[model samples]
Target chain A: MDLPFSTPAGPDARSAFEASVMRHLDAAYGLARWLARNEQDAEDVVQEAVLRAYRFFGGFRGGDARVWLLAIVRNTFYTLRAAAPAPSAHDAFDETLHGGEDGAPDPETLLARAADAERLRAALARLPAEYREVLVLREFEECSYKEIAAITQLKIGTVMSRLARARERLARCLLEPAAEASP
Target chain B: MNCEEARVLLHAYLDDELDAAASLAMAQHLAGCAGCTQRYRGHARLQQALRDPALRVSAPAALRARLAARLPAPQPAARAARRWPALAAALAAALALTVTLATWQTLRPRAPAGDALVAEAVSGHVRALLAEHLLDVPSSDQHTVKPWFDGRLDYAPQVKDLVAEGFPLAGGRLDVLDGRRVAALVYRRHRHVINLYQWPAADGETGTRERDGYRVVQWNEDGMHYLAVSDAAAADLDAFVRAFRGASAAGAEPAR
Candidate 1:
């Protein structure tokens, strides 16, 4: 693919870069928001990501601008998150996150209750970041599996399995009562 | 595809990521097996819930402005070229005149009916922003916003709360569109405010159009016509519409 900005980071190149990639700001922010789970942290991550993207703009071989920008956003989010003082609970692996068929509600009841936005949000928030990122990329941003794999840096097989596990965990969280569900 | 294999492929199938032959095989297995079908339905419901627009967050405008300010100034070469003072001044004059003419052509009321509606919607959006009159009832709760529109207009506008989907129900107010009072529900996506104008459906037009840096997404659902206007990204506006429509379809109860 033709690189839109081959000039030496000149005015024309800067405009070309902004017009091409900055349009995906929402996509970048959305991914960061889901991963960071808050506005302030998400903003910090996106700010850093944009700077990284701008610095690397000259080297960017134009393909899918959204995906490329999103990959950088995801990487930036993780880098900042790692540098933060405390690791969030979302990073921890809790055995309770699994959905067991033990005394599970019927599908109709489960679906009806899960449709509630608050319940769904709380459930999603409880997922480990790895699981949450895949679900967010797939369902919210509507990225294809290939795009998700590209952004997350996971093999296609790993992406598929992680998504499966993520769905099961989310459903489990949704099915259980809120009080017990808070891990 | 056995239940084991079907279970593994179900997510891909629901996501439409499976190739046709694999998808067909999964579908065929699902058709015969009630257990897998029920599982598929459960997973499908979960997927649908995950698509709630409230789940996504747009970049705040403040962030965009901050980033814009931080960007290094470009085009030293362009500045150098400006050494041709007389020629540069002439070019600038020509550019200004061209801009004036373009603005005049757009601002003139020469657009066809459909285009006129789009322009009016855009104007309404800009007017709300400029006048600082975004809402009469500024509440995030849909119950408050929905009832605020009652008896204010001839038709009842379907109000759906999308706080969970990302756009919070900001409030509702009355706005004039096509010289008739319309119900305008306000929703906020980060710093951007989305003004959704609605009234009894007329037989004129329905689609999306861009005007003056804002997007106007017009559509008819049930008995009312809707024109959602926002300076938010075009994709965000489209998602807002989808979430609005989905929330309306899923239930009348506000997504808390």
Candidate 2:
């Protein structure tokens, strides 16, 4: 039987991989948790992503290991979502709407509600995954537009627009209590 | 830039993704525009809320252990290449054989009753500290930490609040040792972290050993095998063991 233990770096590679990638487990889990919106599925996503990263460690030619791992993490999330569709599969919110629409509350209302972490978390959770992921990468993870683009595999323009729309929806969700019932 | 244009570019400008000229233009607009400035503040506030540490949770220690456990063990072939000097084919073959035997001696299964168990318990404790993943449910209250094991483990491990005993309960997590799942309860003694691993006792034996500068104390109580591992001084660990054993004997339950 042929053993597939032919990676050049050997045991040292395992240690090196852990040193580089394991440190980012929290970040990876954070992203997965937000995207998957549950502890169990988020764990599954991280586990699968870590396995894929381990398998492809030989090809990992040095870059931001967090970004590299998160890219894999997000792709794993989408793949899993597709294979076993989530109950809220369709992201119902309109992505095209720019900042202002009719009856949009003033930013001050949002500012007040945003101070409440529970409300902020709920509003972020209510966003379409598309918007939520970008906001998470940009705001929570503190990734650059370029980094967000790289992780999400979208153009920098798309990243900016998605972030804009995400923030708008978050503002709306915070202000209008009625928005909670829509989904 | 007009209000319309400035508002449109607000996110990009705030994100610092704008070019110097556009950023300068946006800043120039915001200086004169109060409405836009408040809007900018709202966005900043929202971002600040998102940055709350409570928003992001540390990955559970069980998940971390699971990932670490799955990584392939180091193969002997790699070791042979590193240490063996290039020599005649016959000499290389002999060296390979020698290396294989040495590897087998190290890798071969032990009785799973002595050094093997201690080694695993020590490794789990060290990994928790090194990875900085000491807790899955980080709470000082034993009530909070104890119930966390429900549905996650087959049996609920007795969680003792050693706070009054000076080793305060930090939290609890699930870990696998000797190919069996065990509950690792975390405690702190000033700066030192103690991981007390417990599962149903296989056979009753109590002992203490020092390995790699970390002290391991093993005991069987109430049909549970407990291994308390930490880098604390031997005397401190012994004190911890006495306090823990004493607390267990007293049937201490802290106010539910």
Candidate 3:
């Protein structure tokens, strides 16, 4: 539980810090890629995240290093997003087109007809950042609600609701093509 | 529970987040309600599809290598400032204790060279433990731990298996002492971790010192300077030195 930053940074301390952070690189990259929506952007975000994590490593209290690292990645991604230009027209379109709607067909029936991986990725890519992050953490990372709450800094109640909404939106998006084709 | 309540709780149910009683209630509701059960099935399928390992990309090897190569070494000035104050105090106390103890016994006066090295060794040992940098290549096998230092340092340090003597080999790490790289072979004695640092020696000599509640035993063998540091009792470290010397003498290999 030694705060790594408070201890004088030495090569040994740096290596230990590196070992803890490196173990979660893939997971961090995965979250970054999903959030940033591209490999190049993800690479940039993760590299920045690594640097930020190292800078503040001395503050890290020992626990689940993966969760700790992903939280940093999340923060770094948001910082980068804030610095970038405003969301594009397509992003705006995605928001308005797929904004949560009530009285949709049952998600089970909608998802049953959804197509393959590419479509799933497109559907996930279209979700708002908040919803996408929760869904990805839960389904892809296999994080429990508590962990998701910690990583996303959301209350457990918010996490559950966002997850529910994310699923609803994803099911709606995935079912769109099927509905169009049959109608 | 009705369909409306079941729908609200379904995600938590899928995630196994609900408490036992609530989970049981949801299970009971799903059993009786075909609609909620199908919705549950759909949620399960969505989770399964999203879990496609392909969706979670592994960080590319190039990026990993880049980050490893690019990570800044600890700033020397900052490191010195942060590491030395506590050590200087410990060394001062050790010097004081040495002076007091000298008048009471005819024990060999503490070697100045050995005293400085022991302080450095103790600092390295404590830093490794506190920072959780006990090992870079964690292993029990001598061969595995020995080869890990290859190409990373100028000389090969001897590694040995001492599990039979209750000091099991924990692992090895490269440490900087006296402004040069030295091999730190780690061993565990019950709950204590002992750091045995080895570098090329200029002369044949042996000594021991105590600093900040830790004992350090130093020796020279086959042109290698060996300094072992730990918070364990002086008697225990003496036994460790004996076992280490015996093992190294029996299995000494040509230094590379």
TM-score of each: 0.56, 0.57, 0.54
State which candidate has the highest lDDT.
Answer: 2
Listed per model, the TM-scores of chain A against the true chain A are 0.88, 0.88, 0.83
lDDT of 1 at B73: 42
On residues A1-183, what C-alpha lDDT tens digit does candidate 3 reach at each position?
331124324578678887888888989998999999988668867876775576556567789888999998998787767645466544433323234344535655555644377778888887778888998898878899999999999999889877887887777778775523311
DockQ list for all candidates: 0.20, 0.25, 0.18
Better of 1 and 2 by TM-score: 2
lDDT order, best first, reads 2, 1, 3
Q: Is the docking of candidate 3 incorrect, acceptable, medium or high quality?
A: incorrect
On residues B32-80, what C-alpha lDDT tens digit does candidate 2 reach at each position? 9887887787787777777888777789999998777555436433332
* Clash count, one per candidate: 7, 0, 2
Write candidate 3's Cα lDDT for B1-256 as tens digits.
9877777688899989999999999999999988888778777788787877666788999878867644544543334236544333333333343333322223335557656566657656755553344577888888788888886566778888788988989889866665565789998776567889998886834787777678878888878888888877788889999998888521366544
Q: Residues B13-83, candidate 1, lDDT per residue (tens digit)?
A: 99888999999999999999988888788888888777777666778999888777545446322442354
Ranking by DockQ: 2, 1, 3
